[model samples]
Target: MSVVPGLVSITFRQLGVGEILALLRRTGLEAVEWGGDVHVPVGDVAAAKRTAAATADHGVRVAAYGSYYRAGDHAPADFDAVLRTAVALGAPRIRIWAGAAGSADLTTQQRAGVVGDVRRITELAAGEGVEIAVEHHPGTLTDTLDSALALYAEVGHPGLRPYWQPRLGLGPAEAVHEAGALLPGLVTVHVFSWTADGVRLALADGAPLWQPVLGTVAGASAEAGAERYALLEFVQDDDPEALVRDAVTLRSWLGGG
Candidate 1:
């Protein structure tokens, strides 16, 4: 199966749903992950449904619900609403943060809390036929590859998956290895290029790194016949022009040209 070149709508925070869909269509992208923090707020069923419909109207699929539902930090009631919103948006999966603290900084109690929540949430999502994914991010349990793997082992839920991203501080080789290690459980990828000091660069600047990451992901997806999306995340200066240009770069990276 071919890996889909997609966009995470939050990357274009300034644009409304209509504008975001239009921009995505023009980029020749096939899917979008709508952000709950902005484009579709949790519990806003009407907005979620409308955005989902608009995406389909533009010939784009709702890849996943990019929710800010931080596991172990929020209440069950909040998670319930998050699931409902995902159902409304017709998202196959819901992306969440691992926890409030980094793996190194987490207390034993915190780790247990996160594991329990992840396990519970996985079950909750399963009931709705929706998958749950933890974003590989800093200040969360998935800050490091080892920590992410360990968290998965602790949860051990088939419904749980990781949304892998190129760790900002790592070199190209290390980033590729880190993403590869999560292959068995990877459900989606967030693509971006940034410096150790948090400086955002054009997506093409990381081509040497992203190319292999994409290849690894594509290889795995091909074997399983499961769809995977390499969605553009943050762009330089949040400029729509930069996003358009990056989408072009991403298309080429996905072997479009």
Candidate 2:
């Protein structure tokens, strides 16, 4: 039941790597998923190494490399760079998008392309001892539970897994069900709470939802003898200070306090 409290670096896009590391230390977070868009850009092995060293120096682990590599949209060559960065960053996993379009919007050929790309990248990542996870996000194939499951089935690779997050407007019960269904292959969770209308709220406000959600994660991780991260994503008003407050709630929920 090793569910570690961590942060998603993109949560503070305005902050530099050093600043984010300091915030993680100040907040007592154990790990971070560095975003490729900023903190550690794709193909920048030097930056990756530097950030990796700094993270280690600050006593924070690299939970995963949050890469924006769209599974089917880009050439396979592009993923080569992404993998290089993740390897240099010493990340255990690389987070990627299923595709740009929603499941319902994708054609059969489009879906197959995404699936093939996922398989290819999974194999490539496995060679380097790194796992690949698709973002459970809207506007992509993983937007729905059924689609996400089907995509994983078709890819059919143990190296590939799904990163779970409560979809916007999803009720706690439904979120629990989704999390449970994805438990077998769950890698990491993006933790946050938002209103049905998209208003971001404090992590404490979502305790009702997260409490049970994290419980399920703990049980599953224990059963599999694996550790998973509950990484805080965005905070209320995109405020850095909001992260400090949210981290308290997150740590309390994880029984860190």
- The lDDT for every candidate, in the order shown, is 0.89, 0.94
Summarize candidate 1's per-residue lDDT along 1-257 as a digit string, tens digits.
36898999898888899999889888888899999989999999999999888889999999999899888999867899999999999999999998888998978998999889999999999999999999998899999888999999998888998898876578879877888898877878898899878899999888788988899888988888887889998899999999889989999888875
lDDT of 2 by residue, 1-257 (tens): 28999999998899999999999999999999999999999999999999999999999999999999999999889999999999999999999999889999989999999999999999999999999999999999999999999999999999998899988789889999999999788878999999888899999999889999999998888788889999999798879899999999999888898
User: Candidate 2: deviation at residue 184, Å?
Assistant: 1.9
Predicted structure 2: lDDT: 0.94
Candidate 1, run of 10 with poorest lDDT: 166-175
Which segments of model 2 are wrong by more than 4 Å?
Answer: none
Candidate 1 wrongly placed segments (more than 4 Å): none
lDDT (Cα, 0-100) at 168 in candidate 2: 78
Q: What is the TM-score of each candidate against the true structure?
A: 0.97, 0.98
